[model samples]
Target: MDEDDVSVLVASLLRGDRRALARLITLVENRPRLRDRIMSLIYPYTGNAYVIGITGSPGSGKSTLVDKLTGELRTRGKTVGIIAIDPTSPFTGGAILGDRIRMLSKSTDEGVFIRSMSTRGSLGGLSRAAYDAIALLDAFGKDFVIVETVGTGQAEVDIVDAAYTSIVVVTPDMGDEIQAIKAGILEIADIFVVNKADLENVEATVMALQMMLDLSDKGDWRPPIIKTVATKGVGIKELLDAIERHRAYICETDRIEKMHYKRSKVRILEIVRSKLMDKLIRELENSGELDRIVKCVVEKKMDPYSAADEILRKLDKK
Candidate 1:
């Protein structure tokens, strides 16, 4: 029924209907429809807006940095879309980190649209709803979309992969920060930033980052580390310029092709996994086979892998 509703919903979105946009995202996030079919219908209108992903450890001033950037972008006359992803509280199943403060604190700015999102049970610590939100913003014709993640752990790495230019925010006295840099964020960093530059040990933090960058032996496209006290708006423009330079390079070389190809593969896998899992569960319940499979796997009578294979085989018919 939701799949039947999707085409009309998406068409209404294209006509600037906010309700349709909200409903479409809800359907996708809930997997309440033939989501892949709906997504395919909407695909051509996506990918026009720039996605800037800001991620870093907690207490790294990520929210502050994003707030400052929002001001600068508005000053430049861009219609901005902000999606601040806060971790959902497991007990309440709601966003507990209070993201709207940074977004809504910018009163009197009508050109900007600010919305806070919860991770909504995504183990990756991002949201399955995030992609749909981005698409809605893009279709709404925003010049730029800023996605700020609650940078807790490995999920910080996933944020950059979704962004056109990944920015890793850092601060002084972070113990595990250096190790996280190597795990993949360094490789994804189109630009690195050491926030809270006025703090003590600022230079030491910069040096430590430089040492790590040196160890990477990255090619000609070395990601520069910019220092910023975002609350004071220091060094924001330079960081923006660095992002521009990287954008130029990505445009000039084969990076666009490769990036899109990789994005396509990732999107395909995500769509398939979401759609197929939903379909399998529904079909199994309808046939009363889910309990049988669960019993087989739980009783030590069947391995989990074999049980999964059996389900996939059955779902293949649908």
Candidate 2:
């Protein structure tokens, strides 16, 4: 699409056009060249929506929790946007399981918009375009945007940077409370959710988490632990209430501003790094320097680091 088309689509998105919103997200994801313009248009309308990030181990029931939360949010007269990060498809490099399939109930609900994104080999359990997708959802006038990360266990901590409220879900049957501490998941949680509370050894799991929280210096706002059976819609209301309390606490104490500022800094640096690498690689490839360096590395004539430095030196000269 051209500049005029992008502007029109963004206008429609601001006016609550769901199709327009989906198209804009697609454009940003598949066509990286257009991402900056799209985000620049969408940024001003954001900050009105509350963003929540949910992440955990593979079988922690995060998707179910997110679905229940969306329903609860809707009953209270709120519009919801869901960004579910699924594993990348090997064939198409796109999301294999669509949001409609996972969230069949909310598919027809006009108040809720669900979009499943492929990880596309991006680490930290998020799609590379996830931040931009959140902005689009916010600009589309959603009151709440929930980002459910790909279940990559320990390395999923990046969600903290993308969300005002980050929830780390854990199951009782997962075993070994020490694993949580080791994973560094404890550090990022604004709320700790012990889902599947119906399972045995639930108390032990809860106790372990409580003990860990007591030991850690969590600053002024201590993260609360809420137990839930997400599949049966149990304890979901309490979870939502905890989320609200955290939100109010951050807003009243003016910590939300600091969080937003930190997120903005990380995002700007990420964009700059990615763009520079892309441009430098393109330049090297066109000039055959990249091929020469790879050949030398493969033949063990030069180390990878030295080859990389040589490339940078050449670029600096240009």
Candidate 3:
């Protein structure tokens, strides 16, 4: 699409056209030359949606929780958008798309928009286009935007950096799993959900989480641990209440503004990082410097650090 097409697309997206919004998201995900232009056009329309991030170890029932939470949000007459980041297949570079299948219940609802994105092998757990998709959903007038991460093993805390309120979901069955997860991931939680509450060891898991929270250095706001059987929808109301409580607390204390500033800074840094890496790779490939550096390193003619320095010097010349 040309600049004129982008203009019309932006206009339609702002006017709440789902088709237009989907097209814009595709453009942003592909990092088209006019991507910044699309974002600039819609940025002002954002900052309206309340973004919630849900992350946890795999098999924690996070997707089910998100589906329940979306239903709960809809009961309050709120429009919701869900971005479920699934692990990408290395060979195919495509996601299983299971989240979409699980959330087929919402497919017929006009007020609900569900999009499943591949992690694209990002260790951070979120798709690189996640924030861009969130912005598009917000600008399209979603009342609440939920981002669910791939949540393999280490539990990427990057979701915390992007979300206004981050929820960490943990299940009771994973033996010694809580202790195995990174401390940084634990500290990022604003609310914790011990899902599968009906399962054995639920109390043990809850107590462990409570002890952890008690030991945390959260100044005024202590993260709440809510027990949930997401599949059966038990404890969902209380979970939703806890989420709202945190949202209210942040707003009351004016912490939301601080979070907004922090998230904006992160977004800017990510964009700069991506652009710089892309430019450097393109230049190196064009100059044949990348192949030469790899060959030298493989042949032990030059150390990786020295070759990296050489590449930096070449970049500086450009």
Candidate 4:
């Protein structure tokens, strides 16, 4: 779509045109021109939405928690947007889950908008399209945007940094896994949720998490662990309370500066890495070096590590 089309869509979105909002998200997610144009058009109305990121291990009931929390938000007269970040097909770069099956119940609700995105090989968690998708939801006037990510803790934590408040979901039986994952996942959590509370070892699970957090020394923002049986909707209130408490803390001391710094540094590296990789690949293609390296490895004349070092040497030259 063109700039005029984007203008119409943005105007429609502000006027509460739901169809226009969907079209705008599609436009933004696919076309860069439309993405930039639509974002600029809706810039005035942006930042009103609280972007909440929910992430965890594969079986941690993140989807269920999001479903329940969003339902509660809707009942409280708030609108919600969901971005379910699943893996992309290696061949197609499209999401494995074409739609969020768990979030589909909200489709009929005019107050809820759910969009799906692929991690799209953007290993830092979330695709290039995700930023646009979030912007679209923010512009569409959703009071809250909840991003649910795929994969285990690390991948989830990376994406949730963009959120105003991040909830790290875990289950009662994740003791060993939690210890292994603690280093990466603990740092990003604004609120830590131990879902599946009805399962065995609930108290032990909470104690383990708290003990780990205490050992990590993440300063004064001690992450509160809330236990929940998400299926039964138990402990959802405490989860929301923890979110509010963190939000208030962020505003009072204003980590907006720190958040901005963290975000910018990550983004700069993403851009630099993309450019560097692109340059390396092009150099390989031009040098006929990639084919030769494969040939050398097939003949057992050189290993993969040496081939990579040679490639780096070639690229480092002017």
Model 3, span 188-248: residue lDDT tens: 8899899999999999988888888777788888998999999898999999899999989
* lDDT tens digits, residue span 17-127, model 2: 899999999999988868778888888898899999998876688888999999999999999999887765587444346532455378789999988876775644465
Listing every candidate in turn, what is its Cα RMSD in Å to the true structure after a full C-alpha superposition? 3.1, 2.2, 2.1, 3.6
> Over the stretch 38-57, how does candidate 4's per-residue lDDT look in tens digits?
77787677767888888888
Which tens-of-lDDT digit does each residue in 146-195 have in candidate 1? 88876766567777667888898888767566675565667767788999
lDDT of 1 at 113: 66
| Candidate 2, RMSD to the unseen true structure | 2.2
- Between which residue pairs do clashes occur in model 1? none
Show where candidate 4 strays beyond 4 Å. Answer: 89-99, 268-318
Select the stronger candidate by lDDT from 2 and 4: 2
Which portions of model 1 show Cα errors greater than 4 Å?
1-27, 34-42, 91-95, 123-125, 312-318
- Between candidates 3 and 4, the one scoring higher on TM-score is 3
lDDT of 1: 0.77
- The candidate maximizing TM-score is 2
- Looking at model 3, the pairs that clash are none
